[model samples]
Target: MFFFGTFRHSLDDKSRCTLPNCFRDDLGKVVYATKGLDNCLNIYPEETFKVLCEKNAKLNELDSAQRRYQRMFFQTSFKYEVDKSGRITLSKNHLQIAGINKDIVIVGNNDHIEIWDKDIFEKIDALQNEEFESNAQLIAQTYKE
Candidate 1:
């Protein structure tokens, strides 16, 4: 499923946050949350996470770099079920890693969702806007047939 949008949300005192309604159906009941690039947390559907794990498993386990990558990727991951109220409780570790407190921004990154601290997300968003025109032009030029 392709996720596309930027939504603002707040974590309750218990660290529970509601999933955006647009993503709720595609996310199903459970999702895997893990460390993401850019210091955000990634939320992936169960099947998608399994596919990712399978791909990672194909890498040579004998290689030290690969092993370390695998360890970091899997060890920090957690599976969460979206409650009846469409909420998920983020782990304390995950929150701290992403520097998330009460305010958050959930962004759709094509195949997965990214959870970012609101302030951090704003900075990233500003940078994206600054580069958007050039990026779009590059994409258009590269894809032109």
Candidate 2:
């Protein structure tokens, strides 16, 4: 399922966060969390995570860069189960890696969800508008039928 929206959420004292209601069901009971390229955290549904793993598995093991990427990607990844209340507890390492504390901005990233530190997200978002047009043009050309 495609995720498409932004939501503001807060982690409780115990580091548990409630997933956005719109994204809850689609995320399934079990989900996977990993460090994103931009320092945010990426959450994917079980099936999606499996598909991602398969894709990563096909990367050239002989290439140093590819092997290093695989190591980094898998090393920081963790599995989480959505609680009955639709919440998932993030690990301390994950939080530190993303620079997240209490407040977070949850962003829908088409195939998955991203959790970002509130201030960091705002700073990144502010820059996005300026680059969107150029980026869109590039992407459109790549997808042109």
Candidate 3:
């Protein structure tokens, strides 16, 4: 499925955002909230998350850095389900990890999606736009279809 949309959602006290109905069409019973690259929550379906875990597990677990990786990123991940109403009550710690505040951006990212703080996403998007504009030719060359 091609996941595509951008929306602003207000997070309630319980950290629930009414997930868009369209977004939940192909979703499963379980979902995961994990730390993302941009201090946002990366929401992954169970199947997708399992693939990631399997790939990570295959790495050298005996390596000290890998052990630390397991402790930090892996252990800290919070798993929750999309309730019948499509509301997910995020954990306080998970909110802190993603730096999420009142307003959030629910963005569809194809294989997965992300919940980003609105202001943060705006700031990052602007910078990315500028950089992309300046290096459009190089980007085109690097990402040719």
Q: Which has the greatest TM-score?
A: 2
lDDT of 1 by residue, 72-113 (tens): 888889999999999999999999889998999999998899
lDDT for each residue of candidate 3 in 1-145, tens digit (9 for 90 to 100): 6567988899998789777777886656688878888778888888888888887777776899987776666876778888999978988888788788989999888888888888899998888888986689887888986
List candidate 1 stretches off by more than 4 Å.
Answer: none
For candidate 3, the 10 contiguous residues with the lowest summed lDDT are 67-76
List lDDT for all candidates, in order.
0.93, 0.94, 0.82
Model 2 weakest lDDT span, ten residues long: 68-77
- Candidates in descending lDDT order: 2, 1, 3
Which wins on TM-score, candidate 1 or candidate 3?
1
The residue pairs found clashing in candidate 2 are none
User: In model 1, which residue pairs have backbone atoms overlapping below 3 Å?
Assistant: none
